[model samples]
Structure formats: structure tokens, C-alpha cells
Target: MVFDGLTETAVAGRPAWRHDASGVLFRRVPGGTYQMGLSDAEMAALSAHADASVMLDDAHRMRPIRTVTVEPFLMARHPLTVAQVRHWLPDYEDDYVDDDDAAAHLEDEWLDALLEALPFRLPSEAEWEYAARAGTTTLTWRGDEAPTEEQLLDRFGVEAEVAATENPFGLAAMGSLTERCADRYGIGYAEPAPADGPPVVRGGAADASPWQGCGEWLLALPASRGWQDMFTSIRPVI
Candidate 1:
């Protein structure tokens, strides 16, 4: 979604910059008070489906709704891509390799950029939920039910085939793309160690299962600090 020059200026201290590798652009998301968490319908849906999918057990189901406030920052219009990330840190060759070499190399660049951008770094678990919720109070952004196939495909592109529903901000395929929903505190392609496995990249030229794309869940991984085989998509907070 494109923003007006004035809105862009208000949100991002500077004008938006487009990355050379990926056409994906970013706009500043002005932080403000937003209701965070799932609505009653979403909770009911999760309760109804809990027995069918291990992923939806009560423990992991949507939590109580809460009011959250965020400061202004930049968020990528689309997820970060392999090509764009490489421009900043070229040492990463394998799309899924997260190791000491990759982390050490990319950390400096990532940290520098993040610090310069805003008082906030990446969205924490609560922050991501608040932003993804936009202004809604539902389980999946679209509603409790999964979105239609056509709707899913439109938002996620190739990854839509696996998306169960769209989030409040129209973010699709979040859960299925392991990379998108995995650990919330890692940088670049790295997944911290001791996770289920390396994080999977989200968005861009990949397929995920419909069940995996549910907005209420998070894709687990073995590591939290290194690269993964999947492609990366980003939503940067300016």
C-alpha cells in the first residue's frame, strides 16, 4: 500500500527507499494505540478446531485481547527478499544456511540499520500481534474462518496455495511460511539454536500448507540465530 508524501514524511523521518534486488518497498507505519489480540469469534473457531489440529490446542490458541501502544516506525510493504538482504550482507550464499559465519557477517549491518531507523527494533511477540492486528480484533485478520483460495493467492502471490486465512492487515500465509511465523527475535535468516530447526523463509516463490498459515499460530524452528533454507521476507519499522 502506497502512502502520500506527507504521511510518509510523518511516519518515516526520511523518504522511503526502494531496494535494488527486490522490488519490495517500505513505508513508515506510524505507531499509535491499536487493539491487540483475537476476538471472540476467533477464539470460538480455535476452540472448535482444536481437536482436529495439534497446532490449535488451547495452550497455543489466540490469547485475550489487549490494548497496545506503539511508537512510529518503518515497516516493509512486503517481506524482505533474498536479493535485498544480500545487498546489505553478501556473504550469505545458501538460502538456508544459518551459522556463525552468516550471523557474524550480517549482524553489524542489521543492527546498524535497525538502530538508525527507530527507538524500536524488530517487533516483539506482542508488537507483531499489535501491528498485524492493525485495528481488528479477530483470530485471523480476515475473520475466524480461513480466506477463500482466491483471496489468499492475491495477498501471498505464489505462497497463497498454503495460506489458511489473511491477518487483519491483509498479511497472508503468515503461519505456513515457517520463516514468517518462526521465532520473533532473530535477525535476517538466522534462527536461534535449540529451536525445532532453522527458520523457514516466508513469501516469495514457495508453497506452504493451508493449515500452517493460520494467523493464531507460530512456525517453530530448531534455531533462532542463523539462516534457513527458506527465502526471507521483511516488514521493517522505519
Candidate 2:
């Protein structure tokens, strides 16, 4: 199958697409309804397992575990890479990802051009969580198990290898990089979004560190919500 000039295929039951021009693979997320926030139990467990950078209060943003229904959509298997950006903007500069080794750091100014030139756009906050969960109700797509100290530390720094873990939906690196989303973030899910508040960002950057104020482990959770930053990247959806 082909959409937006990309070739699609089914790999091990999950559907995926390859943008030959940019070498970006997109995974198809099936439409369905699922709870979209952290449960009290999950919040407690995550706080216990995370470092001091994590604050119990921050979890309030993901509260009131509400059900969200999403239509099927295609999301980039990995965060947008520098190479993929260059494919659309040959003279692209700023933070770069070499040979798909890392996710590119971009600003919204670039998005204006890219969106006009390509068939991609940022995923919505709901779509992101749904895709990240990959049909799992656990704390992570991996499961509800508490992460060991070593496992939490592993997400602290960025490595050349992208998508270190693949979820059940065949999406890669869903949490490896903090990603830009299409929704504005509010104090809580029920609150109306503040006009000047930062837009919602999802996932943990592979190059995260403890000093960033938010624990890498916390940012990596599927239900975790974050705000945009200089290092925030994106995973395009269609």
C-alpha cells in the first residue's frame, strides 16, 4: 500500500510504511478506545522507582484516567531524524542526527516549511499515548514491572542507536526522545488549556540527564506528559 508517496507493508502482523525518499518508516496504529492517563497505583509505583528529579505533583497533569478513542493513524517508527529533515530541506542545519543515529532537534519555524513540503504532521497528545501504549494498560508498553535502577539509568543519555526498544505495535523509540505534539498542555486533563502555556511534548529524550528537573524514567512512561523544549523532537503522523 502507498499513502503520501510512501510504500506500506505488513511486518509480522503490524502494518508499516517506508518513505523511500527520506528513509523514515511509519507504523500504523489501529483505532480503538483506551484509558489515557496514569492510575493512582501506577503513579505511586513510578514515583517510588524514579529519581529525585521526578515530583509526585507533576503526575497531576495526567490525572483522571479518562478513556480516549482514536482513529487509526500512521506514525513515524522513530522520531524525525536529521537525514529525514535534510531530505526535505537540503541545507538544513541546527541540531543534527547522523545516519539516523539520533533524533533531530527542530523548531516550529522549520515545521512550517516541512509541513508544506511533505505529508507529515505532529501527532496529537492522545494519539501519542495510544501509540506509545501499543494496546497495553501497563505503566509502559513493556509491562507494569518497576524498572531497576540500572534500567532507569540507561535512559539518561542519548546513544547513537535509535529506538532501543520496539513496542508491540512495531513503533520504535516511542520514548527514546522527547517529542513535540499537537496539543497544548494544561495543569490537568480537565482544565482548559492556557493560551500561553507550552504545547504538550511526549516521551523522554535519549540524551536526558538528571539535572533536567524531570527524571528520564518518568518522561519515558506512555502516560507521562511533558512540555516542549529546545531538545524536543518529533515523530510525524498522517
Candidate 3:
């Protein structure tokens, strides 16, 4: 019932995210193959239901719904916090953008320090969705369609009060906050990653409609790329 630290009960039966020495929390994702991306019929149906405010011009970017085989890995139970990032590498800010300028701006020692200090890294696009799906076929880990404002508050609570309640996999905020993903990809499966394609932030934030969470995914620029919002956070996988 408690998610404070790694427990035999939590890790023995299912993969779990528990407190780490650095104060970060992580869950285990057992390896397996799963469908990734939208199907034609689902896309058409989703497009019909898509809200005008959150319209995505390119749904094809996540298409072809391929079956991906992943290796067993550990995932952050919650999005990485500014405090956590700073703990491992003191200079990284909470809203540090992961873009080219930011990367270039970082002290040469930061990356190496990050690699050495923590046993975590960002999750790939495929790995992210697979964990988000958590063995479901619907748009959300919760349901098949967009949810309402009431739905989100009731489910996870603001500030992750009830974050550990629903997701069977024990990974937090897959449908709530915009956490960082590792892939630098473009709009279509066939389209090559833009020479400038930035990594993506997955899941929906509190400010947006809960209905949008199932379909929300925003892109982030490289390092301290001033494009970050309050809801932007990091969810590293190892």
C-alpha cells in the first residue's frame, strides 16, 4: 500500500519503483513485446473526436502501430524533479531544456557527471509508450477516450496525491504530466528525424483538458531550451 521505498511485496510480484540512494524513485518494467502507435480505424475514430484546441496536424508521426520488443529496464516511478536533478548534478535547473543550445551551454563536466552520478536516463519513445500503455489497448492507461477535468482530479489528484492508485505497472504520471522522452523523431514513421528534431514530452499536464491526455505529446528543444512549461518534468528509465 505504501510507495515509500522498495519492498519485497512491491518488487517480488510486479515491477516497482522505490526510493533510491539519490532520492529518486524507480520501478521495474519487465521486458515484453507490445503494440506501439495508432491503428487506421482507431486513428480515424480519434481524429473525429479530437478537440479543436489540441488538434495535431500530423498523427502519422506515431503511426504504423508496430509491435516493439523491449528489454527489461527500470523506470522512474515519477517525473524527475528539479531537486533530484540538482542533487545528482548541482547545475541542472528544474526546467532545464534539453536542446542544442542548452546542451552547448552546459559545462563540459555536466553530462559526464550525470552519467556517473545516476543510474538513470531518459526513456525512448517506444519504451515510454509501452510503459504508458501498461498492457492496455485503449488510448489511456485508464480508458479508451479523452477524459474530463473531473476525471483527472478524481483519479490522480493534483500534485500526484493519488498517483500511485491506478496504474498497475506502478509507473506514475503516464497520463498526467509532460515528462521527457529520449527519441528525437519527426511527424511520421517514414519521415526522417528533423536535423533539428527535439526530444518529445509525453503525457498531459494539469492545465490541459483531461480529455487531451490520451493524445497529448509535446516536443522539447535541446538544453535549457526556454520552451519548458510548469508541467514539464523528467521521467528517466534505466
Give the true-structure RMSD of model 2. Answer: 4.0
The candidate that wins on lDDT is 2
lDDT of 2 at 217: 59
TM-score of 2: 0.82
Clashes of 3: 16
lDDT, candidate 3, 20-89, per-residue tens:
4555556777789987776554445456564522333445556656778999877866665555657667
Total clashes in model 2, counting residue pairs 3 or more apart in sequence or in different chains: 2
* Higher-ranked by lDDT: 2 or 3: 2
lDDT tens string, model 2, 160-182? 23334568887776765778888
Q: Please list the Cα RMSD from the true structure of every candidate, rounded to 1 decimal place.
A: 9.6, 4.0, 7.7
Give the whole-model CA lDDT for all candidates, comma-separated.
Answer: 0.39, 0.71, 0.53
- Candidate 3's error at 88, in angstroms? 2.1
Candidate 3 global TM-score: 0.66
Ranking by TM-score: 2, 3, 1
> How does candidate 3 score on lDDT?
0.53
Candidate number with greatest TM-score: 2
